[model samples]
Target chain A: MSTSTTLEEPKTGTWDGGNEPLKASYGKLMMWFFLLSDAFTFAAFLIVYGLSRHSHLPYTGSPEEFQFSTEWWPIPEKVFNAFPGFHGVDLPLAFVALMTMILILSSVTMVLAVEAGHRMDKNDVQKWLLWTILFGGTFLGCQAWEWTHFIVGTEEGMLLADGTRIFGANMTMNQYGPPLFANLFFFITGFHGFHVTVGWILLVIAFISTVNGVYHKRGHYEMVEKIGLYWHFVDLVWVFVFTFFYLI
Target chain B: MAAHSDHSNEFQQTGEIPKAQTKVIWKTFFILVALTAVEFLFAFTMDAGTLRNAIFIILTVFKAFYIVAEFMHLKHETKALIWSIILPMALVMWLMVALISEGSYYFDSIRNYFN
Candidate 1:
């Protein structure tokens, strides 16, 4: 049998001219994708934390005979109650609020740096980038102090029945109601801190590059914009972490 | 090449000094600060319960939206890009819902079985 040969016109799919559908640079688009994926990672951690908190056995007995019961979970306000230099004071969430402001201010400085980059004003870009770095470093210092306070377990930590002092935070145990609670705290906050540190290094690099007139040579300050995205994403993740881990 | 030189000249003329963005940036900073302050206030005042937690989640989402829109320039980007990020996030939310419900069931079973 002879088959009828039909030459059909090929249908064209979506047109992508290698142009950014978002009008963003390839770098920025990729940065956004990375951040979105990072967000899911953070979400998984926080959701598990919430689930653990929901199922945790709260400490109901006295300090000396501290025991975990399924009845209650340790209050976040009670756990994170200590403040810097106020050794005996229970300033719940005050220092953390300050930390939040520091991150916000750093984000502001980062945007200012990007704004200066847009103007191609190298001096302002360098100045603002340096300020952003300073703020990030300060925030990191505060986090270090917080971790030290948490690990030292001066007043908040409790002794368990097995004679294991739930001092500081590790993967195994915590003075907090449940080991999972502190584990999530350390992991989530540490992950976020790592991001902040990376962003700070990137900022420093961007500062040097700006000083060296790299973007000036490239005819645009898009590198600054890209780094700003990363920095702001760090701050953005911290917002969620603060809400779930500290505020809630 | 003449084309390469023209491209550089065009880029030079396009990006003018953006003073307006600085003002917008400061405004966003203050809004974030104020929202954080409000969160702290609520944390201190409101009783630790579901309602307070819901409000915190709402406020956090709002802050996240503002940061992404203004700082990340998502507001100026195309709808396709915005939805690409947001729609995938909805899937994350679904995962959260599914996993959290599963966790609740597990907790109930453990509590009922052991206690």
Candidate 2:
């Protein structure tokens, strides 16, 4: 019955009997753990990329010297240069930068939604959530276009020593540096994209719930807070992905 | 799940997060944007090599810090919760650093395939 009292501020320590060790609710702590595990999963994928990339010979030449080959790993910017309408004009990493900006903006809106929820302002929460969803949708659209461009390859393609014309990247061969390049590209971005898609779904559900006054009726908006944590984690992962996958 | 109860199974939305918090949010947003701009500048202006790569990773960590600490409110959390998440991630980061350090060493041997 003493644990039922909310007057005491729980501090950092073990869960002896009545105190929250981390000063967090059971659910929020578990959510943190879930995100930690998810971080490991992403770390695993990125580590493999690190190892694979290092094991190959990197293309050390200038932009003009750049060419797709299995013998060397391509510069990521060079490989990801295709922007939607600007065909033949080399705009390296510009579109992916836009994608990064969009995701960061969504993350901003998400935190705003969490803040609005803290104020117990249902309309504000709904508005911010909708904006966040819009940003997330835009990021996903950019990713779809990027994937299409990579898969479709360029106009000239690549000439192999074996007299094969490889148009795009695939499991067998690619116009890019190596099959592993395409493999990791899809696996890494695909997994991150899947997280964004799920985050969008969760955002919609939270938005609908806010519209229906679920949090208002329940007298708390901690649902928004938890989802905010997850959404922020997604953005956090993108920061690393941009560095490791794109920049490095 | 009222804020007044500690034994609740779920976290209750508590006190006003201070209108000043939005100021902090916008400040962080600008910081994130500025850091990203610096990264893009480095990407184009700087030559490709170990130094550039190092700068990129460091800037990325800075962006990650703002997003995690400010946007996720992890900085405001209790020490136990903060360390619980950060320590493991520190190890993961260590693993990355270790691998990247060895990357150059690995590169010398692998380039022999083409040479």
Candidate 3:
């Protein structure tokens, strides 16, 4: 699945051969299968998230008068209110909304690049892939910044089950409502961030290949389409992540 | 026409985007943006409840489907390929519902056992 299909199609043959089974090339069919398994992995993670979320009581306190309780899940809007430029502003969902927009935009560029590849237009592929890589990189950078703030903890801090004041999040403890809440945040978003980083590297390599006429030499640009599939899945996963972690 | 743009010969390399296709792509982008904005509006204005959670999950699923169908070209693929991917996801979604519904029971049992 990592490499592109190098064999040219058997132009107009009686048997479609093993290569074109199910009306898709071997590479594409394999990519879809891989994506299905990946989807299962994510679904399992998120289902666990949902379970952990419902096990705890809801945070009944007002966001303005927010206080963490060991028995309730953290109110996300209360916990994730810190925006980049503004201090002490009650701007919940602002930064995450921006992150989601950036990722969705990158997915668009990736689709454009794939569209260009289908046309065998090398220059357009290069251009759109450049934009996709830029957006992906920016998203990774934003995630890094968000993680930094999350680790450093809020200024007011949170009360633990022990009645001790703690700052940022760690494995066993956090200022957030449940240690599980913060733990899931790290695992889910960190896992997605790792995907974005890998996809960005792949996009850069794909960009370089577009520039060097690698696909042109091979007489097809199916590689871009394959990578586009991966890139879009990354974007799709983030949509779920943003919904689960930030919004609700 | 979109078909011509899709199958333009190797000699036609002006780096021009397919106009109709670009329109569709931008339209999808705006739809996603609008959906996110609505989620934001709800986040700020409405208090969180089962209703809000349902709306968010439904909207998120819609966005996810749109991306897979359009961006990943799953809609363009054959029906066999499509169902093979979606059916299992449907089952997984069912599992999600089943497990989450049992969560309160799990919590109760664990609390009882511990106490």
Higher DockQ: candidate 2 or 3? 3
Best by lDDT: 2
Worst 10 residues of 1 chain A by lDDT: A62-71
CA displacement after TM-score superposition, residue A45 of candidate 2 (Å): 0.8
Candidate models: Cα lDDT each = 0.81, 0.86, 0.85
Residue-wise C-alpha lDDT for candidate 1, range A1-248, written one tens digit per residue: 87988888665443435444467778988999998899989999988987776565545454334333214666667667788778888678888888999999999899988888887877789999999999999999999998887767655356666765556666666666566776787899999999999999999999888777778878788999999999999999999999988877
Model 3 CA deviation exceeding 4 Å by range? A1-21, A160-164, B1-20, B111-115
Across A35-130, the per-residue lDDT of candidate 3 in tens digits comes to 899889888888889899878777776667768655789888778888988987878778888899999999999999888887777888899999
DockQ of each: 0.50, 0.37, 0.43
Q: What order do candidates take by DockQ, descending? A: 1, 3, 2
lDDT of 1 at B4: 58
TM-score of 1: 0.86
lDDT of 2 by residue, A104-134 (tens): 9999989988888777777789899999999
Per DockQ, the best of the predicted structures is 1
Pairs clashing within candidate 2: none
- lDDT (Cα, 0-100) at B68 in candidate 3: 89
Q: Which tens-of-lDDT digit does each residue in B9-70 have in candidate 3?
A: 55444665444257778888888888988888887788778899889988998898789888
| Residue A72's lDDT in candidate 2 | 88
Q: After superposition, how far is residue A90 of candidate 2 from its true place, in Å?
A: 0.8
